[model samples]
Target: MALTNSQYETIMREYEDRQTASRHLLEERTAEVYARVEGYRGLCESVASLSVSQGRKFLDGDEKALEDLHASLSSLSAQKKYLLRQAGYPDDYLTPVYNCPKCRDTGYVDGSKCHCFKQAIIDLLYEQSGIREQLESENWSTLSYDYYQGDDLQRFQNAVKECKNFIKTFDSDYHNLFFYGTVGTGKSFLSGCIARELIESGHSVIYFSAAGLFETLSRNMFDYKNKDDIVSFHEDLYGCDLLIIDDLGTEYTSNVAVSVFFSLLNQRHLNKKSTIISTNLSLEDLRNRYSDRVFSRITNQYTICKFTGTDIRMLKKRLQNRK
Candidate 1:
């Protein structure tokens, strides 16, 4: 939710590198064209020299000088483009380029952080959340259904349709997802898919396993010395656009963990922030383990997804061994 000073520096350095690279590329392109296009350099110099003189004359109340400057500059620009094409170069070969043209790689627009900068902050946060690399292979780009068949395939397809709908309407509607089923039934993979899609769309997403989620909560609840880290950590968990808890119910059972979990659900629901939880626990087991209040919050606020399919991982392993 908040970028640390170090992250800000890192993004600035990357922008600096982009600017340097763009400048170097432009210089090289300019030099290459100048060497091949006869009179191109002189034309460029003439345009610059005319701009200064004409600008001064215009300041001195010479309207004719302004008109002449405009015509002369337009003619020179056309000639420059013709010469570049004759020399087999693009007309805009010498134009400045940027990885992000909106801010010209400056990471800011009109003194505000650009969209690219915000996305960069989210990306770094994703890395720190410990799911960046995993998402690369689990997202939409890598979606596959080879391990599914029969009713399982139909169930998976239906569940996927709902997931897609959830993502599609995510901006206009505040909805949470609860994926509950057997282990290795693509529950976690689906969670990653949603996280990846939202993250790429420039929404902030934080992914944590149930154990890690509770562990961080436990630390924040008890660790008074590291007030800064605790505050930031909790803010990220509560304020992120999406928070994913994978393998829920695997965490150590304790009153503190339950209390923390209950509070997290309430705070996120109150804020209208979305949360996704995937667990192997059945509905009855969830109610028994986490208490009725916690279960009630989830059932009321989350769209329950029941995953029923062959264990994709084990199916893949078996298929591999057969091969």
Candidate 2:
């Protein structure tokens, strides 16, 4: 979710482009109106003059200036509408249009990030989350108990219950989830279910495979020349509402990776932001790969759902081939 300066600039440049497009459109409409609508130019000029005069007169303590300006504007508006209709155009054709009416496509409203801007970020993250397509078919509503049995079924049901609770209370409190088990034991699928539900309800979510996460961290730590890129990447990792690190212990690990991972994990815990991590590594494997502190932190603070079952992906593929 952390953007390089160029990536950040790309989004800002889009906002600028939207404004420019809107302005050019208004200019074209104004020129068209002036050319086709007789007396429209004069009406616009009169309104402009009235606006300036009204502001100046009000500043000079003319108490009736605003009232007089309103009456004049209303009269001018009627004439303008009549002129546009005579020219076969709408009355408000010259009114400015914007991509985001709330922010005028400036990406900020009331000096905070606008809903449109936040949605833009969410869209970007959706593309990067890696589970976007899977979510469509893997959500809770599409889940089937037929795929599980015995101990696996019991564990799966329990995990679903816990995830539902997580979703229900997500706004009231903050918590993290750690999913560890055999490969294809429904870890990432359940994670995707949680992600889809929260995102549909308007929470910011960023997902990274362990490999992608470490690659980004390494790129920021050693490959980037600007320190701000490194800082911004860390800021993004810490700032999102939910961060999912999937397939842990599958990445190329080094000193830098371990350091960044531990730091990121610790900071998120301190900030009380929810995180969901799924890994094929067992508890003992995790302790051996990462430090005991990292293992201890997760075990102590996160709700653990241990998964055990046959590989569901292989089974599904085999079934598909049969069909």
Candidates in order have lDDT scores of 0.86, 0.85
Estimate, for each residue in 1-323, the C-alpha lDDT of model 1 and write its tens digit: 44545556777898999999999999998888878889999999999899999999989999899899989999999999998888888888888998888999999999998999988887776776579889889987788887778887887787798799989999999999999988788888888888888877767788889998888787677777998777667767788888899999889879878987998999999998999999999999999999688999999888888878778788889889998
Please write out the lDDT profile of model 2 over residues 1-323, one tens digit for every residue: 24445446767998999999999999999998888777889988999988998999999999999999999999999999989888898877887899899999999998988999878766665664567887888798878777789999999899999999999999898899999999888898888899988877767577899999989887876765788766766766887778999999989997767878888888998888899999999899999998777888899989999988889989889999999
- Per-residue lDDT, model 2, residue 244, is 92
lDDT (Cα, 0-100) at 56 in candidate 1: 98
Q: What lDDT does candidate 2 reach at residue 185?
A: 83
RMSD, each candidate, Å? Answer: 6.1, 4.1
Candidate 2, which segments miss by more than 4 Å at Cα?
1-20, 50-72, 100-131
Clashes of 1: 0
Candidate 1 has a TM-score of: 0.70
The list of candidate 1 runs beyond 4 A from truth reads: 1-105, 110-119
